[model samples]
Target: MASNIDKYKSDLQKLLKLGQQLYYAMNYEVFEDKFIKNIRTVMNSDEEVTKFIKDLPDFDLKYQPWYSESLVLIKQLLPDRLGDFIKYYEKPKNRKLLESDNYTIEDYLQGNIRNQSFKIATSVGLDAALPQFRQQLSILQSIQARFESSLFDIRQLVQADFFDSELAAAKELLKHKFARAAGAVAGVVLEKHLFQVLCDHHIAIKKNPAINDLNEALKKNSVIDTPQWLFIQRLGAIRNLCSHNKINEPTPEEVGDLIAGVDKTIKTIF
Candidate 1:
């Protein structure tokens, strides 16, 4: 079985390769004609141009899968770059033709724009997208530069995959009206995540720490700020109601909130 670090390294490399392919695709669309023209004039040889063209790696980008996966990783690891990374991809809601209505890569990928026209060039969005892809690639490269220290990130990513699966199971339970069971499942996820966070911060664990105990430990150690501390405290209360309280049944709505809250906390806190 591949260890978490190896899995993380592989994932990062895959993202980097996909990003490079996407960049190549966009670059080819934008400058292939110019490149061929320049190379033909400079080399004055058809054989050389044919060889160059053949050497270019063939790539057909299924943009959404790469974009979605990279977006999630950027949101987790390098959140400051997330906005710009998204800006180049998501289509604007209100596009003013003469104003700030620049086309996006999404428009090009979705076939919403022309290949060549008198109005706009096929490279309309490449200007924005190429730099963004480079930036995201840089983010991955920097992470790869320091492999050992990134184990924490790898652990978080690995745990995130498990948490997402468990939450999906909880969602299925909720859909069947097993509200208490769903809440219990969500509460367990939250508790397990909190324990993991404690371990991440190297906090000493007590025997059988409850959600409240873990929350308090995190708060007292200044691992979480006041607002986050209070938020976890509220989650602990909801978890208690779901796990221990036996009088009133947990509403689907409340259990839904618990599941959603757990999801957010697990994604954000680490």
Candidate 2:
């Protein structure tokens, strides 16, 4: 069985190949009369004429788009090109015939519009679709060229988003006067982020490492200098104060500082 990444690559290649084939099929329909003219000399027999006028395969044009999967990957990996990719496939509203008919790639595939003859005649059948599909194919190829690296970046992006949400939740807790709870939430984010950083650097650590443990490992591995190590130690102390020191409640200021420090550490360290 192929992995999702492998499937994604295969789908991209298939899309490009199929897009090219569809382009050729569309052109064959548009210039079919010209094809007959060029092959007139060879039409000596019925067999020759039949061979020469054999229908081109337009079945491939009905390819069910892998849109659901491709769109998700596009949003995550090539977000900048996402709009254009969608634009090429969807029917544009208030479109002019001079610009384009309301017809789109979807219309072409669904048989809602014709590529041949006077019925549903338009110059922008697959011509409009092919150019933009080629652009999308190029975008997919760029991602394929650096797939592993792009995956790593995606992991980092997802983690960063999670960390941001955690911090926001921590802030909401602090606003409700639950300083200890806020610090704990912030502490978890900091700890998880450090763990990820260690894994990224391939540094060995225990299954259940403390914030200080992760911090010390990072410092020992030279991932962070002494100053950063000291800063993290201070942040770790505040986390301990909030988590373990039930006798003394953490101040709002201390929890606020801890959250801010953790936010900075995750962003700067990684």
Model 1 spans > 4 angstroms off: 1-140, 144-154
TM-score of each: 0.51, 0.46
Task: Report the lDDT tens digits of candidate 2 across residue range 172-197.
Answer: 99999999999999999999999988
**TM-score, candidate number 1:** 0.51
Candidate of highest lDDT: 1
Residue pairs with clashing backbones, model 2: none
lDDT string for model 1 (1-270, tens) is 564457667887898886776666666766888767776886758998787666554433456777777776666565566777787667777663412245566665654534443465443444454564566567656666656563434557677778888899999999999988898898899999999888977899899999999999998998789999898888777778878899988888888888999998996775
C-alpha lDDT of candidate 1 relative to the true structure? 0.74
